[model samples]
Target chain A: MWSRRTLRQREELIAYLLVSPWVIGFLAFILGPMLTSLGLSFTETDLFTLEFIGFENYTKLLSFDATRTLFWTTLYNTAYYVFLSIPLTISVGFFIAILLNQNISAQPTYRVVYYLPAVIPGIAASLLWLWLFQPEFGLINWALSLFGIEGPRWLFDRKTAKMALVIMSVWGAGSNMLIFLAGLQGIPTELYEAATIDGAGIWRRFRNITIPMISPTLFFVVVTQIIWSSQVFTNVYVMTEGKGGPANATMMMVLYLYRVAFREYRMGYASAYAWIFFLILLVFTLILFRSSKAWVYYETEIGGQRS
Target chain B: MSGAAIGVGTARTSVKRARRTQVFLIHTLLIAGGIIVMIPLAWMLSTSLKPPHQITKFPPIWIPDPFVWSNYVRAVTIFPVSFLVFVRNSMYMSLMITLGTVLSNAIVAFAFARLSFRGSRVLFFIVLSTMMLPQQVTMIPLFILFSRIGWINSYNPLIVPHFFANAYFVFLLRQFYTTIPRELDDAARIDGCGVIGLFLRILLPLSKPALGITAIFAFTWSWNEFLGPLIYLSRMETYPLAIALSFLRAAHGVLWSELMVVSFIAMLPPVLLFFVAQKHYIQGIVITGVKG
Candidate 1:
C-alpha cells in the first residue's frame, strides 16, 4: 500500500517512529514541566488552589527582606560550598592522577583503592562521614590527637561544618581522578620525551606540554564539578538530618527548595526559586563554554583536522 | 682507560640509585594516600563488628574484640518489616528502571545515530541541551503532575520517566552506535533485515559494552536514588534502602554498630558490581569526559 513512497521517505517515517518515545518524553517530562514551573512561578498554588500573583515570588525572594526569606543566605552557602569543594576535589584528583600515571608497580590496584570511596552510595558515605566527623570519638579527631592537636567540633559547629563537608567531598575526588588519569594517559609520551630532549626540566615540561594537553579535560572536570557541587543535596541532607542546620550554615538552594515545596507546601515560591537557580546554572555553563576557546586545547585543531 | 671505566660504573650505579629512590617515594606517597582514603571503610567494618561497649572507646578500636557478627543479623531483624523488604523494593525499582532506560534510550539513540530523518540534528542538539536543565527546574511541577495523575506514593513517578529516555544515556549510546560501520547496516538491509532486526540482531550484540555501561549506570542511579523515593514512596514497606536507612537513623538514636551494618548491606550490591565491571565503569566515565 505504501510502495509508491520512496525508500528514503519510508525510512524517515520509521526513524520518526523509533524516536517518538524520546520526543513524547521530552515534551511530557522535561519541556512540559519546565513551562508549567515557569507559569507556576507567577501564581500561588497548593495543587488545589491557584491564585495569579504576578512576580510576587521573585520579588519577595529578591527583596531586601532576606533575613526572613533566606534567599541570599542559601545562595551564598551554595556558592561557598561549590567554590570551596570544586578546587579541592579537582586539585586532589589531579594530583592523584599525576602520581598514578608514573608507571608504578600495581597501578591498577592503587587506582582501585583511590577510586573505591567514590563507589560508595551517597547515603552510606554521608552516614559514615557523619560518624567520622563526630567531635570526640571519631577517627579524624583521634588522628589529630595523635599529632598533639585537639580537633575542632566538625559537623556540630557551624564554622567548621561546611569545611567538614568540603573535606568529605575530597575523599571521593577519586572519580574525578579517574577522569583526569584517563586524560593524562591520552597525552602522547613522545611529546614528553621530546620535551626532555629539548632540555625542559620537570616543571617546564609540565607547564608547556602537560597543562595544554589536558586543558580540555580540566575544562570538563571544572564544569561538571561546578554543576555537581552546586546541586549537592544527598550528603548534606543525610549528614545534617535534612535540616541544613548549625544555624542554616549548610542551607543550599536545592535543600531549601525541597523544604519550601514539600515541607512548607509553598510550591509556587519554590518554583520561582527553581527558575532562578536554573538561570544561574545556565549562565555559568554558558560562560564556561564561551571561555573554553581561550583555554581548552584541541590537538585535532593543531593537526588541521576538523573532527 | 681503567679510570674512565670506573667513572662510567659509578655514574650507572648513581642513576640506578636515583631510580630506586623515585620508585620508593612514589610507592610511599601512594600507600599513605591509600591508607588515609581507606580509613572510613576500615572504620565502618571495624565498628560494625565491635560490641556496643567498644564503639565509643577513645583512640577508637581498630579491631573489634569477640567480633560481634550478630550486628548484621540484628540490623536486618530490627526493622518493623523484614529489612529484605527494602532490598526487594530497591531491586525491583533498579531492575525496572535499568530495563526501561536501556531499551528506550538505545532505540532512540539508534534512530539519531543511524537514521537520516529531518530535524534529527536539531532534535539531538535539543536533547543534549536538556542535559543542562537540572531536575530542580521540573521537580515541583513533576510532583504536582504526579499528584494529579494519582501516581503519588507509587513507583510510576520514579520508574516511568526513564522509559522516555534521558539525555545522558541517549548521548552515550548514540556515540557508541555511530562507531559501527555503515557496511553492516547495508548488508543487513540487502538481506531484507528491517531496522528493528538490525538493532536486535546486529547492533545490540555488538554494543554490549555500551549497553552494559548504561545498564550499570541506570541500575546504580536507581539503587542510590534518595530524593525521588523520599518524595514518591511514603509507605514504610515501599521505602528503598536509602530512605529506610535514614529512617533508622532518625527514628532511633544512632545505633552505631547496627547502622554501619545496614549501611554496608545497602552499599554492597553496587560496590560488588563496581568491582566486577571496573573497566566498563571507567570506560563509561572516560567516554563521558572525552565526548562532552
Candidate 2:
C-alpha cells in the first residue's frame, strides 16, 4: 500500500498525463505559431523559402505602400459592419425575444423557425444570398418591383455590396436572440412585479429593469459581434471571390490577408497584416471590457465579474 | 374618490384595448420577419427547379412552370468522380472529429471539474486564451508542422487535432460536468469504482446533453470547414463537400440550377443535425453563460 503523499503525487502525475494532449496541442498548434507569426511580421521571408530579411515587412507595411488605402477601407467597412450589425441584431433579437418571451401561440415553433438560419452552413447561406441578390432574376428585386421601387445591382455594385453583407448578417441573428431570451428568463420575476406595482408601463419597465438586467449579456454579444465581424472573411470570400470588388467595396481586412498570404504567396507581409488586425481587435475588446463596468448590471455585484 | 375610480376604469379598459392591438402588431411583425427570412430559401428552391432560360428571367419566376427533379441528378453526374470521394472524405473526417472531440473534451473537462488536479485552473486559462488568437496567425506554421509530420494531404490533419480538447468545448463540458453533483462520483467511489470507472460510468451517462452539443458543433464545423481542407488537401479525392461544391461552381459557371441542387444536398446533414439536437444546443448556450 502506498503512502498518502505518494498516492497524491501519483494522482497528480496521472492528471498531468491526461491533460498533456491539450497542453501539447496548444503549444504546438496555437502558441508556437502565434509567437512565430509575431516574429515573422518583422522579417521578410517567404515562409517556404525561409530566407529572412529583418524588419523589412513591418517597415514596408507602415511607411511605403499605397496599400494603406486597402487597410483603412477594409477597417472602415469592418467597423461599419460591426457597428451597424451589432445594434440592429441585438435590438432585433431582443425585440423578438421580448415578443416570444410573452405568452404566445406556438412559441416553440416560432423559435425554431427563427433559429433555422443560424444552423445553415455559411457557404450555403452565402450561395443562397447570391441567388437572392441576383440583379435581374433575383427574388429581392422581384419583390422590390412589386412595390414599384427599383432594386440596386447588389453584388455587382460597389455601393450596395457591403450593405448586402450587413443584410445577410442579420439573417443569423437568432443565436443572439436565443441568448437574449435566456437572459430575459434569468431576470427575477419579482423585479417586474415590483415595477408593475409602482405604476410602471411596459416600455418604462423594460428600459429601467430589463435593459439594465441584461446589460452583461448585451456586452457579451457586442464584444463577440465585433470580433466576428472584423474577421468576416467567409461571406466576403464566397460573395466577392476575394476580389472585394466592384472596386474593392467589400474588401475586408481578413479577406485581403487571405489573398495576400495564400493567393499572392506573401506570407511574411500577411503575417504583419494579421498582427495589425489582432492589435485592433485586442484594443477594441479591451475598451469594451473596460467600459462594461459602467453599464453592465449583475444580479450579485461580485458574482458577475469575469476577466 | 368616485371620479378617480371612474377615470381608472376607463384607463384600464383603454389599456386592455391597447394591449390587444399591441399583440396583433407584434404577431404581424414576426410573421413578416419570418417571410423575409424564408424568401431566399424559397428563391433557391425555385431556381433549382426552373428551366435554363427561366433561371435568369426578369422579375424572377417565383414558381417553375415545369418542376424539374432532374437537376439533382444532373448535378451529381456532371461533377468529377472525385465529388463522391470528397463526400466520403467529409463524412469520415467529420465523424472522427466529432467522436474524438467528445471523448477528449469530456475527459479533460472531467479532470477540471471533478479531480483535484494541480495547475488545472492555470491550464484551463491557457486553453481559453488560445481561443482569442486569430486562426490566421497559426495557419502557415501549423501547415509547416503538419507537412513535417507527413500529415498534409491527409484527414489526420483535419481530424487529429480534435482528439485534444478544444477550449470552447472543454469549457462547455466542464461547466456541464460541474453541475453534476460530486456526490454521484463519491457514491460510485464508495461502491469501489476507480476514478476512470466513476467518470465513464457515472459522469459520462449524466453528461449526454453536453456530449450531444459538442458532437453537433464538431460535426457541423468539420462539415462546413473550407479553409483547413482547402489548405491541406490539394488532391481532389481528399476534398470535402464544401471544397468540392466550390470547384463545381468554378468549373460550371452559370449552371445555377445544378449548383443549387448541390448546395441543397450539402446543406442536409447540418440542418438535420440541428433539428435533432436543438435542445442540447440551446441548453449548451444557456449553461455556458451561467457557468462560464
Candidate 3:
C-alpha cells in the first residue's frame, strides 16, 4: 500500500523518464561536445598527448598569415554566397509563391515543377551542375551560344566559382518558395479586400500588404537560409573535389574546418575555428532577431512587447 | 443613350481581352520558369542515354539517337564493388533514421507537451535552441568521440544521434501533440494509462500525420546527407550513395554517361517518394516555415 506521496513521486519519475532521451542527448551530444570543443580550443591536443597552450590556437588564427588567409577567404566566400543567395532566394521564392498562390489552374503542378529541383539530393544536383558547368561542350555554354552571349566559365573560373554556387542556390529556392506560399495563404482575404477598397494597384498591394504580412516569414527564411547556406558543404566538396581550389577560392569555413581537423589533424585549431564560426553565426542570428523588430510584423506580438 | 451603351460594350470587351492576356502571360511565365528549372534534370536524363561518342561532341547530342538502356547496367557494374551495396547501405540508414527519429521525437515531444513538470519550459527551450545550434563546433569533438567508441567506418555515427530525437523534429511533434487536447490525456490517465501507455495508445495513434511528416523529412535528410557519411564511413563497403556517387566521378576519368545514369538512379527514390507523399511533404515544409 503506497502512500499518495510515493504515487506523486512515481509520476514525477515517469515524467523524468519521458524527457530523459532528449535530456541525455542534450548532455551527451550537444552540451557535452560544445563544452569539450570550447575547452579543446584553448589546448592543443594530439590524440596521444594534450597540452594547455593557453589561447595559442585562437592567437594563431588571428596572427598567422596562412591561417588568417585561409580563415578570411573562407569567411568571405561564405558571406558572398549567403549575401547573394538569401535576397535572390527570398525574392524569387516570394515571386514564385505569389504566382502559385493565385487563381491559376493547376497550381499544384506548377508548385511541384518548381519544387522538384529542391528535393533532388544536393550531391546529385552538384554533379549534374558539374557536368553542365563544364567549360566546353557543357549544356549551359551550349545554350548560351545559341543566344550569341559568350558564357562565363562558371565553376572552373575562380572569379565565377562562388557566382556559380549562387546561381545553383537560386535554382533550389523553390523549397523556400513553398514556405512563402504557406505564409501567403495564411493571410486573410478580408485584409486584401480592405486593401483593395483603400486604393491599391497589384504591385502596391504586394509591396505594402503582402510583403508586410509575410515579413515575419521573410525574417525566418532570411535568418535560417543565411545560417544554412553559410555552412554550404556538399556542393563545395563535390564540385571542387574537397580541394577548395582553384587557389582555395571556393573554400568555405566548414570545409576549411573539416580539412583542418581531419586532413591536418589540428584538432585544437579546428575547434578554435569551429567556435569562431559558431560565435559569428550566433551574432548574425542575434543581429537578425534584433533587426527583425523593424521589419517583422506579428499578429499578436508573440513573445515580444506589444506596441 | 445609344452612344453610352456602345461605350459600355467596348469597355467590357477590352476588360475581357485584358484578362485573357493576363492568364496567357501567367502560364507563359510559369512554363518558362518550369523549363529553366527542369533543364538540368532533363539534360541529365538525356545525357545518361547518349552514346559515349556523342557525349563530349561540340554539337552536343540533345537526345540520344540510340537509347542505350545498357548505360544503367554499365553504371552499376563499373564501380569496383557492386553499386548495390551503397544503395542498400543508404536505404538502411534512411529507414533506420526515419523510424528512430519519428519514434524518439514523438516520445520526447509527448513529454514536453503534456508533462507540466518543474523546468519543463526551460527544457523545451533548450530543445528549441538545439534546432538552431551551429553544428560545426561540436562536429570535431563528436567525431573524436565516435571514433573512440569504435563507431568510425560504421553506420552508428550516422544513425545513433538521430535515435536521440532531432531537436527540430521534437519541437515539430511537440506542437502537433499539443493540439490533441489535454482532456484525452487526462481521461487516459484516469483509465489506468501510465505515461508510456498514454503516449503509445492515445498520443502516437492519433499523431500518425505528424509522424509521417517527421519520417519523410528524416528520410530525405538521411538520404542526402553527404558530410556525415563522408566523415564516418571511410570504408568503401560502408559508403552510402552520396559518398559512393561522389567517388564514382572522382575515380576513373569523368565517365559522363555512367555518372549521369547513376545520378538519375540515385535521384529516383526521393523524387518518387516526394511525389507520392507531396501533400504531407508540402505541409511539413509549410509548418516548419511558419514555426521557424
Q: Which one wins on DockQ?
A: 1
Q: Give the winner by TM-score.
A: 1
lDDT at position A171, candidate 3: 91
TM-score of chain B of each: 0.91, 0.90, 0.90
Q: Candidate 1 vs candidate 3: which has greater TM-score?
A: 1
DockQ of 2: 0.33
DockQ of predictions, in order shown: 0.40, 0.33, 0.38
TM-score order, best first, reads 1, 3, 2
Which prediction has the highest lDDT against the true structure? 1
User: What is candidate 3's lDDT per residue for B183-251, written digit by digit as tens?
Assistant: 998899889887788888998999998899888888988898888888888789998898899998789
lDDT of 1 by residue, A1-307 (tens): 3474677798899999999999999999999999999999999988789999999999999886867698898898999999999999899989998888776667778878888887787899988998898887888999899999999999889899999989999998898888888888778778999989989999998888889888889998888777777998998898888899989999889999999999888899999999999999999999999998877888877652221
TM-scores across all candidates? 0.95, 0.93, 0.94
Tell me chain A's TM-score in each of the predictions: 0.95, 0.93, 0.93
Error of 2 at A97 (Å): 1.2
**Model 3, span A48-136: residue lDDT tens:** 56789998888888664874548878888899988998889888988888777665677878888888887788888989999998888
lDDT on C-alpha atoms for all candidate structures: 0.87, 0.79, 0.84
Off by over 4 Å in 3: A1-8, A67-69, A301-307, B1-17, B290-292
Residue A287's C-alpha lDDT in candidate 3?
A: 96
Stretches > 4 Å off in candidate 2: A67-69, A302-307, B1-21, B289-292
